[model samples]
Target: MQWPDLFDDDNVDDDDLSEMTRKYLPDTVVWTTDWTTGSLIEQLERNVFNVDPPFQRRSAWSDTKASLYIESLLLGCPVPPVTLAELPAQGSEGNFQYVVIDGKQRLTTLKRFALDGELKLTGLKVLRDLNGRSYSEVEQEPEFRRFANLPVRTVVLRNWKKDEVLQFVFHRLNTQTTPLSTHELRRALLAGGFTDYLDRESASSEGLQRILGISEPDYRLRDAELLLRAIAFVRYSNRYKGNLKQFLDTITRSANRSWSEPFARELDEVVGSINSAISAVYDIFDKGAFQRIDDEGQPSGRFNRAVFDILVMTFQNETIRRAATADPQAVRSAFTVVNRNPDFKRFISGTTKTPEAVNGRLRIWWKQLSSALELPYESFEQVQTW
Candidate 1:
């Protein structure tokens, strides 16, 4: 029993990826770096510095987040350097202005307290003296001018000027420290309809929760990342190059551009496949599988990412899909074989990121299920039965 998949994704060579990724990289200009707090307030007020620029993620700082940075300032601790870019002046658009390429959270914190004086500072671990004081009131205090004059190092890049460059730099900078969650990074770099679809679908998914038995979404977007993993490899397996993170980024980035009715339909098809697979697995497993321990066969609380990959890959295969419709128990039995196979356990526990690992595990799982179901297909790997 063989069915043609939607795409052939068995090979993602370097030559294919090189040309695709190069389109996103921008030409760089000579960068000038400077550490300045001199007239920084003037710069904010002059329409010279734009904190919330287009295509940037929303400034997600709560007052607590804001206070931590301001606290660092008041206590004279050096925070991370802010990265800024100088955009060349557009004649009709406006004067040349600097955009906060990185450090939007910190810069926005500055705007909230130091400039607008809107938020009163609180929870100061070091500067307990200035607790519960806004910058306006604090500036009047004798020792407060020192806090106001504290220099914030800004790394300004001159004419490193392309929107692609800005997007790339912004992605890199934020990914370095206190790194952006997978969804947050995707939303920032690839804001548009398709990501919006992924969000709504991920949130509303009863199937995802039931299969994994998760009560809520992972704050780090691990669940969403796995969902994305299934969607990507199923559709673009051969299209994947070395970096899985960038591969996911590319999927969202391309979706941001090619959005329309047909694209919506395309998304619908993928969602349909994923949801149907989840429902079938639940129908077969009785109590939603994959939590049971290997060898001992006792259920565990923690969710394993590698096992989720195996199950999703199983559903993606045509033979298992047809076989599961007949007896989901047989599919469960195949999972038992997976646990029993020593090499399968090590492979699932190993570096699941590599293409070889990913494809190899899937092939191994398919071999197990194929033998258990006695389904014959051309080119099925000859399995050494456990």
Candidate 2:
């Protein structure tokens, strides 16, 4: 059965895939390469049919994966196979165009190594021989040399179209038992330079844990994963499911790569602003004269989403910064006092009217807080709450 047929817009279980595999040889699927390979393929490439644009983001497979596969093939271990569907050209110059509906990462890496020879690995594992042997003994091991010399494999697909590719992706997303997520499909379908950059940034181990307050042990959420979630929430809110992994895999790849440098710089700046806001709050909670702690000695605090949103807006407007710069702790103390009152939630709710209305009121409160804290006052900028 064709890949599209396998994923028939309904939930397809492992049984379906197993049965399909029985009927079809995995290697029998057709795939073809552009005449050129590597970075050249990206540069010289134009959509012949133009029915579907090649996704802007190149494949996200890293050198590490290449290394592992090279090592695996060297060791004679079978790699997981992927599917390629052929397209019958509507009388295009070329006989066919191949759609890598699956196995994008592996195929991309193979193409890269074959064409440009830019070998680098990040996440792949190092394989070792039993009895602590290593492939390092290349002179002694014929198998090692054979493995090291494995050539890149290119499959050819003829007459592919954009809509069909997209529908195939959607169908795959819905039907597979352990289906590629909508985000993953999105990643595969949409192409952009920023995709790989975001994928790499989101994969960082140390940078994320600090940002998300995740730790080594007693783990639940991962810092890297949470960062993806936060970015998704801030950007295309509610357009995709809340699964951060898929969001990172698919959407991150399709983002504009040109925006990466500025995005990172802006991200750091925003994080710094949030830190300042958090510090301001911490100071208020520490005020022994005005506030007391709970039994566990953590601050008796109510850091609701509304307040968090308000804090984020400090980065949004420069006015909020100048207003909170001087004796910022006192500014936090005022809010803490309001929070401690029996009617605090009601007061905030009444003042803002709704969650969406908080930013405007926050700007006003920021002005008041600045005045009380001996900071410069700036009038609130008008914002459309909705």
Candidate 3:
């Protein structure tokens, strides 16, 4: 992975230089590298450490890969230090936890053995005598002590206040492997209740999966991103302040603050609308509702994000939400209108991340959907809940 170019001092203005320096101001992201496996495991068991940090890749390693890591550990090989980021505490036990920025695969494998006690050491390049032994099966006297004594260098970064800044740094640092999309990065950078909610709630819904033609959740989290796209706008579209991506991130950042009874009710209300929206689309368009145009000018039976966003928001309409199958013909017409409109299609397919494009597509969808569904235009006051 290529690192970002060093700032060009010749071109950097005083303002730019000051901003750069201020970003890394002392104590903003402090670090320490004095931990070992023994201490790390203790913390993990106590729930003081989160092995799977947000923004890091999901735990994709197989037993074979995990075993190789164990072999490396037993051989005292030098693996890279794990990177962690600490956010502002929100006065909860897990709320104050650190997000693992790097070394998630390694750390997760280690934790499986040390804390969960499930990872069995096998396929070793060396230390064959330790083969096929689980952490629990090993004699705790010397073997467990040796495993515990294995050095685990950790660097804790303190006070990264901005979601986008930390997410950018994580995106750069995470390039050691195949890069994740911006949506995937958002999940990590905006580690909190809302992001987690989108993940768990979407992945578990078989109805959503069937409607979208996804047999399972994509590891890239494109499915959850779509769900979040709907929910974000449902909550904040009318009063949207900045860029669309930043607006989504803002929702995620606030989601981490704390969950009250109100948060729960709001979540349920929004999520109910999302489900109803999916039902509405299915009622109108059937299983191929999300199919897209392929390169050969044929409709590919695959889910499309641009289409998904508009449809999801349409269902979010309280009128349509109350009666999705009210006018299947109108729903069909709405879909056709969006696909036929050259400008609407362009807004969705081009510069899709820009505020103008995102907002324009939604507005077009709303206009067409309102006309078709016979629903009154939503007032700005009603659209600012999120």
Candidate 4:
């Protein structure tokens, strides 16, 4: 029986809305203090502060923006307070006293300018005289002295029990500034055992990185997000509705909070399956794996997330993996043929986050690849789908 294609839009349903509306009151104590840039830099130098927390995004401010911020500090302009979360002291052996929950970019700019000597002031409208001058070159100048002595407000949160509250605070704080990516927000809100696991696996998996075509780690966490997509689909496809973000968010939060020995074992198995699947696909397609094939029957362009999800899941079956391994050409031909299909193309391209498109593409690819490999289509049919 042919599975029905239920076309749907990216509308939020009641369950998702409820999830969004849910609220919690965190048991946190907050206090504010004024610290000079010199003091802050000293603390940073002493490694008393963790600027690169797992939840914080990488430094994203351009040189010009960072210079402007430095100029503002020199001019005594009012700047937003930096928010930090205090790390619990563990027998006087803790490395960091606090983690920067907000203002990482600002702190990073400071470190780059004063400590690293990397940032030369440029595009400074107010302090045009400081342009082309490194911090070391102008440290004796009055402007530099004033900038170092400027008092910046710092807000500190301590005794927070729930990480979710910290996530909420980070989310609320960043809504006014440069918007964060979903994966960035996820990392901030869901930094726990499962997310740590995702990070470790994504970083160590050479085959997965080859397929992703990234040598260095993605600062934006897009690579981790892709792995999460594959994991979610492979493990919880039946639970996925039409909302991809909510599905991923819920699963991530749940997995992090409810992590146990059994769950860890299951994840270990899933990671192995993902690795096996990646190996099988890479054997057949090499670096071109998970990319869309162009009209010339050549794989081209960026890696396709939808294609990655389905292929990784399909190849998880040992039978499919062994068949593809034994007949790489036939598997490659099946991939090209399926990519040429109009319906399959649409299923992978526009509006692919919908349940209809996800399920449709998986079904189509599984059917085609199974037939080409001379395997029973019923094997894929028996697998769960939403």
Clashing residue pair totals per candidate (backbone < 3 A): 1, 27, 3, 0
What ordering of candidates by lDDT runs from best to worst? 4, 3, 1, 2
Error of 1 at 142 (Å): 5.5
- The lDDT of each candidate is 0.62, 0.42, 0.64, 0.76
lDDT by residue for model 3 (1-386), tens: 11122111111112322443456544366677857777876766665555554423345677888988777766667777887787566565546666666666777787898777878877777767777888877655355666667887888878765555555555666556555445665675667777777887777666566754457665556557666767777766664653555666677777778656789678888888788777777777775575544445444565566666666766666666554487786766666667667777676554555567667877876777777766677642244455
Encode model 1's per-residue lDDT on 144-163: one tens digit a residue.
Answer: 55556677777876755334
Clashing pairs in 3: 53-100, 55-188, 235-386
Clashing pairs in 4: none
lDDT computed for candidate 4: 0.76
Task: Determine which window of 10 residues in candidate 1 has minimal summed lDDT.
Answer: 1-10
User: Model 3 segments beyond 4 Å from truth?
Assistant: 1-35, 46-48, 52-59, 86-97, 122-131, 139-153, 180-200, 207-226, 253-258, 291-297, 300-302, 318-337, 369-386
lDDT of 4 at 135: 88
Supply the TM-score for candidate 3. 0.71
Best by TM-score: 3
Better of 1 and 4 by TM-score: 4
lDDT of 2 by residue, 115-182 (tens): 34455333435544422233344326665555544433444433333333343433553463433433
- What TM-score does each of the candidates earn? 0.63, 0.38, 0.71, 0.67
Q: Model 4: C-alpha RMSD to truth?
A: 7.6
